[model samples]
Target: MIGLEGALYPWRFRLVLALLALMVGAIAWRMLDLQVLDHDFLKAHGDARSVRHIPIPAHRGLITDRNGEPLAVSTPVTTLWANGKELQAAREQWPTLAAALGQDPANFAARLEQNKEREFMYLVRGLTPEKGQSVLDLKVPGVYAIEEFRRFYPAGEVAAHVVGFTDIDDRGREGMELAYEDWLAGVPGKRQVLKDRRGKLIKDVQVAQNAKAGKALALSIDLRLQYLAHRELRNALLEHDAKAGSLVMVDVKTGEVLAMVNHPTYNPNNRRNLTPAAMRNRAMIDVFEPGSTIKPLSMAAALETGRWKPSDIVQVGNGTLQIGRYSIRDVSRTQGQALDLTGILINSSNVGMSKVAFDVGGAQLFEVFTKLGFGRDTGLGFPGERVGNLPNHRQWRQAETATLSYGYGLSVTAVQLAHAYAALGNGGAMTPLSMIRVDSKPGTMQVVSANVAKTLQGMLQEVTESPRGAVRARVPGYHVAGKSGTARKTSVGTKGYQANSYRSLFAGFAPAQDPRIALVVVIDEPGKGAYYGGLISAPVFSRVMAGSLRLMNIAPDNLPLPEQKLAAAGQGGRN
Candidate 1:
């Protein structure tokens, strides 16, 4: 019995010792794997769990007008963020946070609990400083505030379309903001902070990066001119009972846009009910058939080719010329008989202009129009600028060619047409139109011969002086040369134009002898018993020109009336 007991005890002791050795080996292997092979993975997991990244928002830039009036500015705001796990643990205290944030406690609690696994989450974005301070005062676990910027437009609706606005992230989203986003949007930075086990920021660690503020942008637009144009455009819209209106004033020498005003403008500061149409910069985006305003270009092309003179007479047969299956007629059928080239433009004779365009051929017409910068971007740095549609010569039918000559079939933006007219005013030199005044030498391209331009200027002056012409566009005490255009709005897929619905346009440069400023005014479907450009748009042009000239202190060359001669009595008596 003593021998059996000894043997059993020895066997049990050996088995126990083997099991102990195996367990020790397994523990050693695990230590080796975790401490050596899986060291990096564990270290990363620990770092992710403890380290917090705080985004350092860069201060958004300011946008100023030419005279240094702030159009758009960035004001300080606060962004609320939280550690999801800590926020969920402090769910009972969320009501305090929610009340400070003006959010429902249940909803806020759900949001916090929903993303507990996430290391960080934005509780609220773009909070006012006061509200953010209130939230900070609550001292809720895991809740924190960071400095950010919110865009503010001081001029508000007055400069809405031009200055544009930014998104909640302080990113440029529209207008000049979108155009210069890269230069205006500075580099975003980050800040690292050390946190305790309770998810409280113990202390600020070393700053990982520093935020660089964006560069301020200065626009070429004048605030005074912009305000004046806005007031006038708004008044014109109401008075004429028009659907919409846009006016642009350009510096002839530099092509700098002085003012660009569109009716039905909205406040960029508070865009609660912003419409796509209200956001549109019609001066750059909307295109229309140019009607008689294009006659000067066509006639200039004809004159430039040495094919027609101002005195050249075309016998317009009862103000109608049949081209192919279509017949082009004058706006006024009552006017009859032969009309000279000057008379044709003065009378806005489509028949005579069509005959001249037919004589000039499409190739020459296309070349001239292309040189004037039609069917191409104007490089004005505006958003959504349409190049408009100018059909190629190959695509042009005989009738299309004739119709195009008198400003049909082809379309152009108001800015493009203004630039073209400005070229005419600037001694036949085309300057690059710019909305931002960059310090650089002005580049001028010779589009029309000086002689031809001078002659056309004379003819356009006559167009204003003639009885049936846009005489009302003439500013008193100043020589104003311009043309009025009334085009029927064309419907898509329809063969004909819409009656009673018209686009009225007046394009001119004041002090015609030596042009100073080139302006264009357009009214869409004026309801005040006048859809004619001479009646609607020309008057606005006149008022704006008069005001601009007076403001600029431009000396009137034709001012101071001459004394009436008594010889007129003798002349009348002799007759």
Candidate 2:
């Protein structure tokens, strides 16, 4: 054992071996003290002197249309930040940094003074890689570029209302962006890493927190249909010289918003001096009295009473019926002295509709309207959705009930109106609407009996094929069923309604027998010659629906047999 461990023949060799053993033992003891006994303290000391906890910016989610077309995206960008303390001492580097950042040197110095108490200050944000490299090439002290994300909108104004823009801090401000803020903006993480004297990344010690990228979101919007709706709505706005307008289309089967657009739209990318009124999603936020479009729903309500029939006669003597102070009248006697339920709608006779509502009473009408999702939000979860008002049954007077029958005395958002019509077209079942792509089929809620809604659907077709129908709304190869609305705008700051301002609207479903889609077209304050929904709104509806139906590959429901030449004459569209 002695020979294996050490040779002890010479005293010089023995002494050398003994000294070496003592030195090795001392070194091992010191290592044990540091590695086991005082490990936590030693590690903490080393980290305090040489380690940094750097934050990793979380990447935001991408937003794409249902068909995979990108509406909003986040591109990799570099954000230049500076250590205020280090920069304070690098006075000579200020000009080089300021010039690279496109800032006046004096202004940059003043900003540094303002942020002197802060450890970090942003020198530049959202810079291109090339630009960041140039700034770094100048070798400005205390300045570093961080890899971050900046949102980019490819569809621009076409989808501004749906995919709202984010702020400079990468937070959502409006539309879907605001609605899904947390889902799109993920949690940022931090890493414990070492850096050299020049602040260059060295070795990664450990991750304090793992960075999680935001999950991508897919919308229900069809970008192709959105473009079509936007183009048509814009053309109508310019042609009529209208103040504003909006258009919405829903897939009846899915209750998905295929297209939603508003005129006077602004680009989401460059939002300078953007007005709230202009930024508003009119289809979901703006509510207006629906005029005659309510006629179909009213008709459906009347039929639901079991006391009224579609063929029941409504006496129209001289086309006027006086209800105390209100005079419910048809424009002229052009409609027959007496007409059936279908005639009342085809003629848009206020007297006929008022009489029906009077017979049905206020409670029944309210029931049907509420079931159709009026007086409440559509639950689309869209930002700024307005729940329109519906007066309590006790508050509704006889005349008020009469006016409500013809789409007055209460207001409705365009999407609500469309959803109601879509309900009727979908066999009296209402599907919950959504802006996101739902994987499962949405459950349906029964709004009215299938027979009642179906009967109303058939009568609505007469509005486009009868002698007094809205011919412009007729598609070349599809059976269209729809109703027109022309309501006078209530005075903004006064009690009475406006004399000339009107909201023209058309709501309907195509292929009346087997509807696949429902559309709503509204033009606010149309002024060029014609203001009637039949003339202004229906034409836009026709153009948009034709393109949209074709884009969806829906088979045409009407053949080459030309429809009867019709015009909305003699019948009054006013409620």
Candidate 3:
């Protein structure tokens, strides 16, 4: 019986050993599956347990003026982010962290509790470097600060319209920012870092790719001229008691915008109180019906057609003429029944200009105006520019045609009108208006005959020198040439005009004999008892022109003679 019991015990022990070996083999197989066969899934699970990703921002480009002055720049900043899961787990410490960061403790805890599943979340952006350092020194479990860039506009409102502003993430939002987003937003790169069990950045592994900064943009805006124009426009708005004003100065030769200023401008840095009206770059975006300023183009067409000469006589008919159901009249009635073309321009006769348009005909008039860059986009590359309205010949009624002859029934931007005048000043060559200089050679288009342009220049001079016109636009030492326009603002849903609401415009070029800078000034709804362009807009033009000329070191057209001779000549002439 003992032998039999011993043999049974050996068998039992063998059976137990076999079962334990089977258990060990099963455990090894499962381990191999998880560590090797299903490696991706298990690795992802492990990463979910310990690894975290933080977004890295690429620095935005710098915006500089033509002379390399910084208009917009990017400065180092700190952004606060958090691992929501960890922040929620460390709830007790959140109160202290919130107080140190000057945040509401309740809200901070609530936000972390609400988004605990999210691995990454932003708490604050665009904090100064010092503030970010203070946040970092807190050594909170989940809160972290990273280096970033915040855009800074050094020129403030002066360059606001041109340079534009960026979003919190350094993305371009308007103006040049929106226009050149791809060029301004640089490539983003990644960084591989090791983290400890508590989710702290323990070791920085090899960087995947080094981040590259964005390319800098050098604009064609002249800072000095821009400041000058802004100051003058602000003063003009105040003096005229105007609702708003815009002034644009263009270099005739290169079509570079030397300065563009709009009153009621808003700083892009702080746009909390900005209105759509304040953000409007009226010089490029707003269009008005040009008024008598359109006369020169009509006169140019008539002269080009060989149907009229500067000295040719026409019956002005008591400063009034009727065409179909509409009647056109001059500002003042003169005794002359007939007047030459120069006399018509000098008096700014609506009747004479309408007759000139009639002789030139609708087709020819439209062709000439279109050729002179009216009612078209100047391709200046500014955002929100309008391609001002001009009706086709098929759309024209007799009244429309007649009124358009003297700058009505058609809309044009201030920049377009200034460029048209520049074309006339630059001997009929139409250069592309530019806000940024291009490295490629610029091309020119011939818009009018040089002879015709010279004749138009003389006619514009007559308008400035005329007693009833824009005499105030004249510079003291230069032969100024320009025109005045006062158009009643059309009220919405109304057939007639609004009382005391007018857009007054003064457009011209300076040193009239050989024109240099072409300028346009527009005042919206002047309330200083005078709404006329000659009164509200012309003086602003004069001041800007004088300052620009002096800044550019242009020689004065008139030089003072010896005091004794000048005084003697004046006395003798009086005698």
Candidate 4:
């Protein structure tokens, strides 16, 4: 019985050995097939699962002021994403991930379900690097973070309108940002990276394409002047309880915009509950009837006709003129006054300007306005820049002609008005306005004769220097040349003008003897105290101009004789 049992045990052992050998041979054959015969295909399939061509985010360009101070910049950040299907598999870890993301777990779950068919979904965007790292450290399956950039504004709302803002993905959205998007947004790159099953990056394999960062953009805005303009415009709005306001400053010689500000502005940094009204760059977009601000240009047109000199008298009887279908009356009490061109401007006599326009004729007046950069592009290339309405001369009715003479029946933006005034200050040469810095002197067009510009400059000086003119626009010790406009606001949803609402405007240049800067201020619907341009907008002009001239080290033209002599010696006739 023992021998029979031993024989059976050996037979069992042989049977077991044969089975083990067959299993080993099958395993070896399978290994050889995978590693040799199907090596490339299997490796490619594995790499398709583990390796990824990840995008390397390129840093956005820097937006700097003329002085090299950063207005808009990109800061390093991270965006966390998840493979929806993989993340759904790790349902137990959803709560932990949701807590780390500062999201409700149920909402996170719902979001995941909504995007379950999507291979990839953004879990959270624009997180701080440190915080993003902490979430990745949790090692949740399918969770991953990619390097990105977030736009930051250092000047905040002060330069928001001009420098503009970018989106969460660092794309330019408004202002110069939107205008120069291609120049600012750089090309992204790609690289092969090996990732684990949990979607965690293991190592970079190879750079398929190198990333190229965006180029730096330098704007014409002077930070100092911008802040000053912002403060003064904001304060003026508060002081007058005005609905809105806009201010623009330009270099008379270069036509570079030095400062531009608008009220009801928004902080580009935090755009929560942002309104569209708050984001408008009013100086560039909003238009208003320039009122008496157009008188100077009308006077220029009158002068260009060679029929009326600056001293030519126009009969302004009873301070009213009856054009067809319109009875235009002067706001100032210049009753039965026969005033010259200068007197008419000083008094802002609608009757006097109407006579001038009538004498010049509509065709000639429209021609002059066209030459003065009206009803045409300012060549700023800015987004939403409106060329204010100017009617054709052939279409002008008698009332249209009269109203056009005294700055009605037409519209203009603050920048356009400022640009026109800058042409006057720049010896009748029109330089295309620039939002970017001009390293060299820009080319200019001779819109009007230098003699005509000089003559108008002298006349405009009286508008600020004379007691009857915009006296509030006077900056101490500086000769101011500007016009004051108190235009009636057009009624909303109606044809005629509103009785109570008005737009107060002041457009001018400083140091009339040798104008260095031209500025325009517009205060919409002043609800407190005085509403005249001389009273509301002119004072703001005064304050901002005073600071701006001092900052530019411009010599004051109205200094006392001895002080003037001293300044001339110090400046060496530079002014």
lDDT of each: 0.86, 0.88, 0.84, 0.90
Task: Give model 1's TM-score versus the native structure.
Answer: 0.86
Ten contiguous residues minimizing lDDT sum, candidate 1: 557-566
Give TM per candidate.
0.86, 0.88, 0.88, 0.89
Candidate 3 or 2, higher TM-score: 2
Model 2 CA deviation exceeding 4 Å by range: 1-36, 195-208, 561-575
**lDDT (0-100) at residue 226 of candidate 1?**
85
Give per-residue lDDT, candidate 1, residue 447: 96
Ranking by lDDT: 4, 2, 1, 3
User: Better model by lDDT, 1 or 3?
Assistant: 1
Per-prediction RMSD in angstroms? 5.7, 8.3, 4.8, 8.2
Write one digit per residue (lDDT tens) for candidate 2, span 1-575: 66745554667677898999999999999899999998988989877777998988888998999988999998878899987877878888888788888999898999998887676778889898888889989876677888888899999999999999889888999988889999999788998999775465688889899888887889999999999999999999999999999998988878988889998898987888788887989998898999999999999989998988878998889988887777887764788778899988888888999988988988888989999999998998888899999866676677988989999889999999999999999999999998898778989988899999889889989888887877789887899999888999999888989888999999999888899889999999998778999889999989998898899998997875333322233234432
Assess candidate 4 and give its TM-score to the true structure.
0.89
Candidate 1, residue 3: lDDT = 71
Candidate 3 per-residue lDDT, tens place, 71-141, comes to 98888898889999888767778888888778898997888888899878998888898988887787777
